[model samples]
Target: MHTDLWNTCLHLYARPGVERACLNLQSQGLDVCLLLCAAWLEQRGVRCDDARLKQLSDCAEPWQREVVQPLRHLRTQWREASAHDEALGALRGQIKALELEAERTVLRRLESLTQSWPSDQSQGDCDWLQRMASLAGQPDCGALQTLRAAINRA
Candidate 1:
């Protein structure tokens, strides 16, 4: 199982449809870091327990909410203006870098939090998806299923 959370995320996200699925879920208020962690845990065969899920969520939520999301918002909102304004474009680039750093930090924290978890027998992909969905406040959706499938393929 891949223990490097950031690298694992990059690899998984490079797969077809995975990025779209993640962005869709994120737009719906799902924490992408949490989703990625859930996928990694599932890949590792770690049993998806409530306490573990809560721990991971607690670790990532604050950083994602405070740091990552704001940078993402700024960069995304500036996309059109940035194309026309050099200064705004440069600022957007910085924000994008910061957003990436914030995500990396969160992924690193997640990796540390889960590193000690011993791999167990396969508890199935649906198990982690259900737990993630519960935490994300997302009802069953095609994107969620796609994410689960993409993660396993990763």
Candidate 2:
């Protein structure tokens, strides 16, 4: 079995600058987990299309917008308070954990979406980064540069 998309994203995001890059992209409304799964699938030569893009969007957005982002935003809002209030810090920590879990749930959905794609290594040279960047509506230079650098490193 291939390494799961969640594990792949976790590993890749740990690479220097990747976490920052992902956060930068995420702040701009791009779904980093879905992008990582797209990279994973494209690496395996899987194809992408509108329907697939919609599926990826459908898979990633609700949880991100509804669950993860709210938890994250609330946690971020507490950052300063957390410094002064141990109780606030603890609550933020728990919310942070829940946010992480919500993200992991999205990653799992992305992984499941790509699992049935045909395994053909030659087909993977797709411009997934460009596709994602374009899909994001506003092209963020830092985020695109980060993804491009990461993909080239592969």
Candidate 3:
């Protein structure tokens, strides 16, 4: 398994069905970066608790709202127009890259936030994925299942 959250996300997202599942979950109003971080924390055996959950959410929400979401919205808004205009298409690609970089920045922030947290001390009930998914209002989503299965395989 990848040691870092960014690499883990890249690996997991490339796995069969993972991209689609993640996108589906995103459509349902879940933060894909947060979900990936949850999976990484779970894999690392990090103990989950209310406070940690809040910390992660707090750290991610602002960045997602202020940085990532705006870039994504701009890229998405340009999609149709870009298809018919070469200049717009190039600009959209640039925006897409910026969006990805913004996500990477958030992932780095999350990793740094948890850098001092001990892993492999989690109790059986400390499931970060479940907690995050439930918090995002998708406790029983099939997309969540797909993520779970993918992480398990890893």
Model 2: lDDT to the true structure: 0.79
TM-score of each: 0.91, 0.90, 0.96
Rank the candidate models, highest lDDT first: 3, 1, 2
Estimate the TM-score for candidate 1. Answer: 0.91
The model with the greatest TM-score is 3
Residues 5-122, candidate 1, lDDT per residue (tens digit)? 7888998888888899888888888888888888888878888888998898899988988889888988999999999999999999999999988999999999999988988875
Error of 2 at 40 (Å): 1.4
lDDT (tens digit, per residue) of candidate 3 on 52-148: 9999999999999999999999999999999999999999999999999999999999999999888865366677888888887744378888999
Q: What's the lDDT for all of these models?
A: 0.84, 0.79, 0.91
Q: TM-score order of candidates, best first? A: 3, 1, 2
* Model 3 CA lDDT for position 147: 94
**Minimal lDDT window, size 10, model 3:** 119-128
Off by over 4 Å in 3: none
Error of 3 at 62 (Å): 0.6
